[model samples]
Target: MNKPLLELKNISIKYDDKLVVKDISITIQEGEILGIVGESGSGKSTLIKSIIGLLGEGGHIVDGKIIYEGKDITNLNKKELMVIRGQSIGMIFQDCQSSFCPIRTIGNQLYDSMKAHMKVTKKEALERGEEILRELNIKDPKKFLNSYPFELSGGMNQRAGIMMAMASNPKIILADEPTSALDVTVQAKVINELMNLRKKFGTTIIIVSHNMGVISLMSDNALVMKDGECVEYNLTKKIFNSPSRQYTKELINAMPKLKKEII
Candidate 1:
């Protein structure tokens, strides 16, 4: 088998001296989608953030190594880490609005992102931006390139954010509940788009979500978290049909549907 693209070995995180994520380890190979599923406040988000070096103030990585492309990135300096953050590892947070610039045009944002990592002229950046927007199935890229964040709908903004992330052709993408804020119909579309991203680019993805349906649809493997620890990790099919942990079973049962059956 090919080597893993990203690996977290016995990773742990702590906030203000309190342990949050404990000894969690996972490996993601090229083009594979790994789902980290659990309820809110389950520390799955913390795990993802730690990998991307996005943990908030007062939080620290307490243990383990984050290896990417055969290098230990756990202790990389700020300058070295910046090279990897967006160019090698892209991230999509829960709220797209939070990531956008309120005062900047969408095109400027994408252009700036490209310029930051490479020596590209404005015209080249704009062309790359349009290409990504088209890949996301957005119509009228020229109009969108000129529009501000406030001018677009939530779904449009989400796709724009995705375009920004994909602009770099990063090796790994961390999607933290990328569609939780959208309506059910829109959510399905966004999820499908995320899967399509991998299909097109062969980018490894780690999606942290609470929706079992989303996980089952997008993930090759799923890991279930509770409190501060990972209680279950298995192939997505096995995790759905025959979870090893009772907590995971309960979580699967907790999803309400119109076609209900006895638990």
Candidate 2:
């Protein structure tokens, strides 16, 4: 069996006094895409946030372990955790705008990211950023780099966010609704781009989204969550084609599909 790239053992999270995520365990192997589907307030985002140690003052891990590359990272210090994040495990939020700084130019942000992790000159960083942006299918990478976050379209921002997450060549990428803001055509392009990333870099991915269609199309394994608990988890084909749980069935049925044609 392949060793897991990342594993959560009975992980639970609490915000203030509320238990946002129940005891949940999941393992993601190298080069696999794991899709987490849930309704609003189902604790999907909370689970992702906890994995990267983003829980603020009122939020914390109540129990369990987080293992990455055979190391138990749950108890790592702030400085160590910072090194692990982005450098080893990258993340993309639901809102692309939030991932970037409002005051900094896109080029500067990417430059800082590259400079922080690797000993590279500013010119090298800019070249690296442009290379990634082109890989993500952004047109006119030079122009996009010069523009601020607010100047680009939502789709462009989404692609840029994905590029930023991949700049470090991390082991895992956790994406939360990566294409939620784009139009249908653009969303498809973005999804296809992400699906190709695994093949290009052998990067493990954990995508959290409400879109069942996208999940069914892209994931190898799927997990359904509700009310802060995992209701169902299985192979993606099995989960979509023959859901064992009622909630999973409802989610599958709710997915948009082309109308059946009468022969």
Candidate 3:
């Protein structure tokens, strides 16, 4: 059997000396999508952030190890983690627009990021960026690439963020509620784009979302979290169809289903 692409072994996290994420563990195989779902403050985002060393101020891992491709990265320094982030594990935030600098053109920021991991000219980077944007079904990719982040709509920005994350051609993508901020129509589009991304690049994704519908649509495996603990983890179909935990059942029941009426 092959080893997991990424593994979290009994990981726990804290913020300002207060425990926020309890002991949790998960393994992600290459080219697979793993979804983490829970209500707000369930530490879903915190757990994801811990993987790439983005726990922010006062938040630190207190226990266990994070192994990626068989390497222990739990205590890697900022300099060491910088090499892993983006180049090895990309991230898509809820509001991707905020990731870009307001003053820079989207092309400029993308070129800089690309240059960080690989030696690529401005023209080459722009061309590659355009290619990814086009793959995401963004119309007139060149125009969007040349424009500033503020000029694009929220949906466009989110798509561009996904492109930026993919620019490095990372082995894994950690999407932290990538669609939560968008409307239903846009959310569906983003979800489809993500699936398309996986199909095209064979990239491994670990998505954190509170929406069970999104989880059901995107994940091969699902992990149900609550109050910073894993309530249930299983195949997506099994989790939805035969949830063992009451909390998991409630989450599934909460999803909005279309009703048919007979006259």
lDDT of 1 at 162: 84
Q: Write the per-residue lDDT of candidate 3 for residues 200-239, one digit (tens) a residue.
A: 9999999998788888888999999999899998899899
Candidate 2 — which pairs collide?
none
Q: How close is candidate 2 to the true structure, as a TM-score?
A: 0.94
Q: What is the lDDT of residue 100 in candidate 2?
A: 91
After superposing all C-alphas onto the true structure, candidate 3 shows an RMSD in angstroms of 2.8
Q: Candidate 2, residues 42-130: lDDT per residue as tens digits? A: 99988887888887799889999999999999878887877888589888877888779988889889888877777778787778778
lDDT of 1 by residue, 77-127 (tens): 777777887689988878887788999999998888888876788888788
Candidate 1 segments whose C-alpha is farther than 4 A from its true place: 256-263
The CA lDDT at 252 in model 1 is 83
The candidate with the higher TM-score, 1 or 2, is 1
RMSD of each: 2.5, 2.7, 2.8
Highest lDDT scorer: 3
TM-score of each: 0.95, 0.94, 0.96
